[model samples]
Each structure stands twice: as C-alpha cells, then as structure tokens.
Target: MNLKGKTILITGGASGIGLESAKQFLALGANVIITGRNKEKLDQAKKLYPQLTAIQNDVSNPDDALKLYHIAESLGGIDILYNNAGVSNPTNNLAKANDKITEMAAYEMDINYISVVRLNNLFLKMLQNRPEAAIINTTSILSYVPSNLAPTYSATKAALRFYTASLRNHLEVAKSNIKVFELLPPLVATEMAKGIDAKTITPETLVKALLDGIQKNKFTIRVGDTKVVYFLSRFFPKTAYKLINPVKNSIKLSA
Candidate 1:
C-alpha cells in the first residue's frame, strides 16, 4: 500500500514498536495519530516527533476505542489502523497444578485480544471506503510458540493471530479492497521485554521491515527471528516449544 498522504492510527504509539512505527509512517508522508493511556509518554513522543497527533486512549476500553474511531473519522477516516497496544507480565513463575488464572492474565486477554477485535470491527467500514487501506496487527513470535515466562501474553497473542487470520479470510471472501497485515516480531529490545535477556531487534529495524512488507503486500510480515519461529511452528511445533521454553526455565534457575 502506498503510505504517502494516508492517515494512520496506532494504538500504544507512545513508546517501543508503536512509537518507532509512527515516526516511520510520518516520515513516509502519512498523517499519523498515536494513542496511549499514559499522558507523559504521549507528550514525550510528541516532543520527539512534533508531526504526530497524540491521543490519550486506552484501547482496552470500548468507549475509548469508540472515541478514537470518531477522532480519526473527523480527520476524514484513517487509511490504516495499527493494532499494537499490548501488555506483558514476564514473570518467572509458570502455572502450577490446580492454579487458578490470575487477574493479570484476564486483563491480558481483554487488552491484547478483545480490544483488537473491537477496534478492527469499529474501523472496518471506514477502511473499506478508502481507495487503499490496511489493518496491521502486531502479534509476537510467542503467538506461535508459547513462552514459559509470559504464559498469558503468549496465549493472548496466539488468540489474536488466529483471529487476524480469520479476519483476513473474511475480507477476501467479501472481495474488500482493505488489506490485513500481521506483524510478528521476535524479542524486540523494548521496556516491555526488559527482563528476558536474548538477542533482540531494535524497534527501528522492525518498523523498517514492516514498511517494506506493506509495500510488497506481504500479508504476514515476520521480522528478524520471527520468520524462523513461524517456520519452526509450521513444521516442528514440539521442537519450537522445546527451544523457547528453556530460555525462561534457565532464567528462572539463574534467578
């Protein structure tokens, strides 16, 4: 998709991957609106990239999502919706026998999975009206291989991945011009991923790859080692789980 002159809305765009992506989109001649729950972070992002239109929004809230949609609509509707808002509690503990689900886990599913669905549905019609449009959802490498350290996060992403695929299929069957793209990034060096020490890609690198993927019309864009994760999951799911689960186990042991 040609990003030039398009309006793009990104959730959690105050920092990390979302911030970098907003910068890139602005650089590519797109009008970018970034939303986050934190006002300080939004201000910080705006200070860095004065071109960005920062909106204080919590995607997990349906009301906030509706407000966001109306805000974008006032700008003549968004050409791209980047669903990137997410949380991760990268704790060392894994679920034990008969352990009940925690509040944090439930919150993860609400924000990561439910919010994405809500926002996508809210913006689908607006996107279809545009000459060219896209919905980019950020699902992680853990979407395929469960992370022992962040079990809830992994499960939420996995659910998101499945939903994204189904949404793509639905759009295709309807012959819609709107494109659906999924970004799978592996171990990005971000504040959200601080505790897990691993070889990581910078947010800038991931955003660059994402822009290129969009131009090439790659439906599922896997950045860095995520491509390997996708391949492993497709061919050797057991091996993929074994390979990733140990990293957290080793970290737990060391701690």
Candidate 2:
C-alpha cells in the first residue's frame, strides 16, 4: 500500500481525478503510465509533467485495454491498476432514446465496468507473479444511490460495486495478495463537475486520502459528503430513489 516504487497504470489520465492521481503518484516516486482518448489533451499533460509517460487509449474498448496492457508489459507489468475512465451522457426525453443517448452510457459501462475486468485479467497473471498487487476501481457516490441524471452510469457503477466485492471475496478465497478498492467519488470540482457547486475536493486532498485509504485497508472509501448518501441509501433505499428522481428530471429538463 505504500506504493513508493510500484508500477501503476491509469485510464483517463489526461484530466480530472485521473490526472490528479497521476501527478501524485509521480511525486511519490512510482512508475506511472496514463492513458487518455484525446491526443491533444494527453500532449498537454505530458508537457505539464515531462516525467510522466502517456498513451492514447480509450478504456471503453476491450481491444484498447488489451493494447494498453501489451504496452505496459513491454515496459514492465503494473503493480496497481487505476480504473478511472468514465462517461456521462446528457439526458434526453426522446421516445427512441437513440444511439447517441445510449452511446455515452455504454461508454461509461465500458470504462467504469468492463475495462477493469479486462485489465485485471491481463495484469492478474503478472500481478500473481509478484507478492503484492492492488486494483483501484473508481466508483461514485451514486453507485449505491442511483442518479436519474446518469441512469446507465449509476447502474453500471452499482454493478461494479458488487463486482468489486465479489472479486475481493474470490481473491481472499484464492489467498492472493491482491487488494481490491472501490472509490466513491463525490461532486469534486474537477473539470468533469466544473459547473456544479458541491464544494469540490481538491485533487491533492482526494489523492492523499485515496493513498491513505489504501494503506489503512479501506474496502470502500467514500470521500466528503458522499459518505452521507451511501449510508442513507442503505437505510432508506426506496426513499432515496424518490428524492433522486426530481433532481434527475430537472437535469433532463435543462437538457
């Protein structure tokens, strides 16, 4: 959990939480490789942090994840995998729900859910070669409490939460040294939540807590006010949905 000399791989590392964590990981003296879909943004990030190595890859694609693993193996097998890439499609009230609407949600599932499965498989073998390994799955506060605004996104993360737990149980049964972590991110002020006024947590704060959470063996790390949502939903699952529906409808309205 110290992660001082570990090799790490992260998706969507060009911006937001992914980029912030990359910066922190580099400062901690770890070998880090970041992946992003935007060539221009990746170049900008590289210029900002010349010590960082970046690859242009989208995690939503299994093929891309395979290619990324191949690229990493060529360098060195990663000790940590950060599944941070995700997407949130704008809501629409159209009767058809068209491909465009579903496309982004599907992208979210690919990155938020499927990419972890793919990378874990590719690196699980290599990780088993080592005595210790870690898998950090970036879920959201809405994972437990569905967000109507991000219908598909929330469902996928919820599914990922269960998947993370199951994977951990299996790892325990297998007596593997790998650690599985679930990150329930709140409305951080990252570019992804730029317009929101939810008192975003600084990148430094989030990463510091994240690394600390890993060291403390925290299975689920809910940052900031997100912790409230997690517990409330657990106790009043039905009422939580009723509250979220109105907010989501408002977002759809604005859209």
Candidate 3:
C-alpha cells in the first residue's frame, strides 16, 4: 500500500524494532505515532525523532488500550496499526512445578497475544472508515517451531499466527477494505534478544523488508531465516524443531 501521507500507529515504539520501524515509516512520509509503557523511553524516542508523536501506553491494560484509541482518534485516527509490542520471560525450568511458570506464561500471553487482538478490535471500525487501511501483527519464526528456552513466547506467537490468519480471512469474506498482514520475523538484534546466542538481523533490515511486503501486498511476510524455517516446518518438521533448538545450546533446567 502507498504509505505516503498515511498515519501509522506502532506499539512498543520506544526502542528496538518498534523505534526503528517508527523512523523508517516516518522517512516514508507516513505520519507516525508511537506508544510505550515507559515515559522516559517515549521521551527519548520523541527527542530523537521530533516528528514522532510518542504516547505513553501499556498495551496489556484494557483501560490504556481504550485511552490509546481515543488519543489516536484525537490525532484524526490511524491508517495502519502495527502490533509490534511483545515480551518473553527469561528461560525457566518448565519441567519443574514452579508457581511463577504460570505467571510468566500469562504475562507473555497478555502482551504478545491478547493485546494484539484487543488493539485490532479497538481500531477495526476506524480502519474500515479509511479509504485504504491495514493491520500488521508481528508473529515470529518460533511460531512454526517451539523454542525450548522460550516455550511460552513461542506458544503466544503461534496463537497470534493463527489469529492473524483467521482475522484476515474473516475480513475478506465480509468484503472489508482493511487488509490484515502477519509479519514473521527471525531472531533480530533487539533488546529482547540480548541474551540469546544466535544470528541476528538489524532492526533496519527487518523494517525495510516489512515495508516492501506491505507495498507489494504480501499478506504473510516472512523475513530472513523465517522463510527457511517456514519451509522446513512444513516439509521437515523434525529438522525444523532441531534447527530452532540446537543440542549444543540446550540447557537442562530440571532433573
């Protein structure tokens, strides 16, 4: 889709991939609005990119989500809602019966999965009113193969992957103008992936690929290693699983 003059709202835009996305989107002539829970990070982003409208918002909270809708409405609404906010708890021993396991899973699910649905529902009507609009949900390569070190995070992405597909199909059947796009990215050099020992892509490279996909109307945009995993997961499930969880890097968290 043509991004020039379009208004885009990106979640978790304070740093990493979100911040990079905001920069690139702005350079493309799109009016960019970004949201994050930390006021300091939001302020930093605004200072760095004076053109960005950075708002403090926690996507997991229902009230904050509604408030964000109103705030975006005040800015005359947005043409694209980029659900890029996500979280992953530190590696835990899932084999052990730890109370924190459930808590961590719930936290990841809320931000990484549920929040995407909530934001999409909140913006659905507004998006429909626009001449041309789109929803971008960031899933991950782990959605195709579970990461032993990040089980809950993998599950959340998997759930989102299915939801995004269903949402896109539903909109099409209803003859809606709003387009739904699912972005499956591989390990990227971001704050979230700091401790992981893996090959990584720069946020700039990832966002560039994303914009290209959006322009070409590629509904399922898989970048870098994600494309290889997607193919292997379909034809060589075992190899795909092993590729994500290499034996040498395996950590035994439980007896």
Candidate 4:
C-alpha cells in the first residue's frame, strides 16, 4: 500500500504509462525496476533516473519472462508487479485477416494476455510472502466495450479483465495480502493510441489517477473517460458499442 521502500517492477517501462509510473514510484521512495524490449530505451531511462533498474526483457517471450522472474528475485523480490506491457494493432476485420494481420493479432495476445498471466503466476508466491504487495494489470476501457480500431487488443483486454477479477476473488478467499488491481485507462496520448483521434489524457494524469486509486484501495481503477465507458457498457451495451465503433454500427444498422 505504501509506496515508500517498496520494490516495484514495471513491464514495458521504456515509455508511456509504465515509464511515468516508474518515475513517480522512484520519487515516492520506492526502488523501481522496469523491463522492456528496447535496450536503448532502457539505457535512456536509466540515464534519466539513475536509481532505476532497467531490464531488457520482452514479456511475450517465455524465456524472457523466466529471466525476469529470476532477476526480480535476485533484487530481493518485488513488492509490486505492474503488468503494463502490451500492444495494439488496428485491424478492420478480425476474421478476414491476412498473414500479417493474423501475426499481429497473435503477437498482441501473447504480449497483452499471456505475458500478464505468466508473470503473475511466477511472482504470486513471492508477493504473498511480503508484508504488503500488489499486482497492477493495465487493462483498457475497450475491455468492456469493443474497439473496432483494435479488435484483438479489445478482446485480449476483456479476457484480462475477467481473469483479474477472478484473481482478486481468489486472493480474497485465500485471505492473502497480495492485492490485484485492474487499471482501465481510456484512450491515452501514447504510442499505442497513436492513430486514434479522440479525447485522450496525458500519461502524467493517468499515473496520478492510478496512485490515487491505489491509495483508496480501489481494485478496479478506471481513469478519465474510461469510467464513463465502463458505465455505458454496464447499462447500455449497444450504445457503448456504437459509440466506440460508429462506422461499423452504422453499417450494421443500414443492413
């Protein structure tokens, strides 16, 4: 719960939300380690924050995931695991996909869904042994309402949302101190949301909301417009779907 002195590991810490989180956590007196696929980016982050421990590990790779776990263990184990590594590839038709589209979709699943599960399972015991610990999964508003622009991304996040909910329930039943928090962010100004022309929040704003949510003991933290999206999807599924993918909805309506 307390950020001070906590050892936190953030996947995809090279840039975007993960990087911002690492920066804030370090400022809060936490020992932060960030994992990424880019060595240059990792080096750059280390330069910015000399206190940070940057590990070049791609979560999508099983070998890399194991390596990350061992590395974290060697760092005296982490108090928090931020499952923040993910990808989004815009695809018009999920089913009618070319090899490239299919590959991209598969890669999205591997990074977004599979990696989260692997890292959590690998680190669950270590977290449980700690006095206080947390697992933060960076899901998206598209977890509930489908995003036409990124069908695979939406589906994987939806899967993660469910899994995270289940994990929370399991931890509660087991009376474990390890907390599971789902961070659902709306369209944010990040590389992942590059082509998406919508009302987007900055990474700093999202990180502030995230820390606030964590402090309040909120398990499901929806930032900015994501809360509205979650509300609409909860009560008005069709309208939420239409709002997120107006063109497809209009085509369906016309048919």
Q: Which candidate comes out best when scored by lDDT? A: 3
lDDT of 1 by residue, 117-167 (tens): 999999999999999999999999999898777788999999999999999
Error of 4 at 187 (Å): 0.7
Clashes of each: 0, 0, 0, 0
> RMSD of candidate 4 to the true fold?
2.4
Ranked candidates (lDDT, high to low) = 3, 1, 4, 2
lDDT of candidate 3 over 159-238, digit per residue (tens): 99999999999999999999999999999999899978889999999999999999999999999999999999999999
Model 2 bad stretches (over 4 Å): 92-99, 197-199, 242-255
Candidate 1 minimal-lDDT segment of 10 residues: 92-101
Q: Higher lDDT: candidate 2 or 3?
A: 3
* Regions more than 4 Å wrong, model 3: 252-255
Q: Residue 171 of candidate 1: its Cα lDDT?
A: 96
Candidate 4 colliding pairs, count: 0
| Model 3 TM-score on a 0 to 1 scale | 0.98
**Reference-based lDDT, residue 19, model 4:** 93
Return the lDDT, model 3, position 146.
Answer: 90
Report, for every candidate in turn, its global Cα lDDT versus the true structure: 0.89, 0.80, 0.94, 0.89
Which scores better on lDDT, 1 or 2? 1
Model 1 TM-score is 0.94
Per-residue error (Å), model 4, residue 52: 0.2
Q: Residue 131 error for model 4, in Å?
A: 0.4
